[model samples]
Target: MTVMAKPRPTGQPGYSETLPRAAESAAVARRLVRTALAAWGLEDQIDDAVVVITELVSNAVDHGRLTSIRVVVSRPTEDWVRLAVVDRSMAVPLMRTDTNDDRIRGRGLLLVDRLTERWGTDRYRWGKQVWADLRCESAR
Candidate 1:
């Protein structure tokens, strides 16, 4: 089961969760995005958000040392929904410069860059937040 945050019609607010990096953080991210969308009555933006969430969680696990992954979701504005993930690593993440070669791994941020309208990072108490903004509407 996934955790659900209560509706707060005010300033910025988010939920945080920690799970082992070995655990299925992607699925939790998916669930968080869906719940956030539904809470805002914007289920139409579901698919796009899920893809972005998956990528974010995957990166957190790959680069982070601690098995714990943290996800934060917020509505920064009426036009965008923000998704963020934190982990227990200090190394910053960068968009993949190399192309997706053979059977190796990578391209998480690359996919995020292409999908999200805007994305950035911020330092947290433990590590950092790699987050992206999803447009509120499909046509946008």
Candidate 2:
């Protein structure tokens, strides 16, 4: 389920929704990203943003060890939109280069790395937030 909450009061274009930590959450995350980018006039970013969010959400759902996760979409600047998945795990994500054609897993982060301007994790007392930034080419 997608929660319709107001943007935070920080004067930034941001939207967040809490979702159950399951594989299906990725679909909800994608929709949230599409809506946010379209509203911000960054429709060009929807495709990549969807992939990034799906990987982030999948990682969280599979490895976060929590009951629920939060998806955050924010326009940090006119030329950049940030997508993040917050979960109750402090384990940092590692990119693996050992996956061969036989392996169907472990390539998610690689896709994220190639598609985003930058991506990283922010550790908090309660959990961690993995985020990726997509540059709004049309804004430049």
Candidate 3:
């Protein structure tokens, strides 16, 4: 995705990273989210946020043919934390419903939907960004 870097107002802290689009990147992404949340004193949100980010990263790696993927984590306001995953695929993420109960996969977006306050995708010239917003106040 063609994400433009915007300046964070005074004390807002954010973390952004680009990693190779490999299976291992999902774990790295989770760790990054965990560390960022801990640093921001939002550890209570870490578990859910990590799960959301892991799913996003996994989806990007599975669908996007790009060599690398970018992840952005930021607290846009005191009440909300945003996590975004960008990959070089123009296709947006869709929720899958056909998988049987025995299937071990096809439930990433479902989990995200249930956990996040809101989630959506933004299309860019280069690709697309899938993002989820978590309510910080509710998290606590």
Candidate 4:
């Protein structure tokens, strides 16, 4: 796995890391986000960001069936932080509502919907990238 962090500019702090798809990749992704948030002095947004990263990375690993994944965390504007997970799958994720209450899975995107300002996917030549934008009140 390779991790790269960019210097923080006036309004932008960004980093991208690539990791082999594994059960532990989700935790690594969370740690990367936490470290970036700390460097950017955006600790106040850690919890929500971690949750969003976990869901996105988990989906990439569990459903995308990818061999590797790239995670990007960036602050496009002072008040918004975007987390994106890229994988070698072109399939877009769907918000599953057909799952029964008795089942204990398939609710990752539901949590993401409630937590992010907006989320979507982008198709690339190799695969797809799923991303979420979280509003950071303390960033400004």
Provide backbone clash counts, one per model.
1, 0, 0, 0
Stretches of model 2 off by over 4 angstroms after superposition: 1-11
* TM-score of candidate 4 on Cα atoms, chains taken together: 0.86
Q: What tens digits encode model 3's per-residue C-alpha lDDT throughout 1-140? A: 89998965722668889999998998888988998888778889998999999999999999997799999998887788899999999998998877678888879999999999999999999999999999895545
The reply for model 4, stretches above 4 Å from the true place, is 1-13
Better of 2 and 4 by lDDT: 2
Give the per-residue lDDT of model 1 (tens digit) for 1-140.
99898866622445457767854778877888888788777798888888988888888888888868888878877888888888777778887787847736687787789888989888767788889988888447
Window of ten residues with lowest summed lDDT in model 3: 7-16
lDDT of 1: 0.79
Point out the higher-scoring one by TM-score: 2 or 3. 2
| TM-scores for the candidates | 0.82, 0.88, 0.87, 0.86
Clashing pairs in 4: none
- Model 2 C-alpha lDDT per residue in residues 104-133, reported as the tens digit of each score: 887899999999989999999988999998
Q: Quick one: best TM-score, which candidate?
A: 2
lDDT by residue for model 4 (50-76), tens: 999999999998867668999999888
Order of all candidates by TM-score, from best down to worst?
2, 3, 4, 1
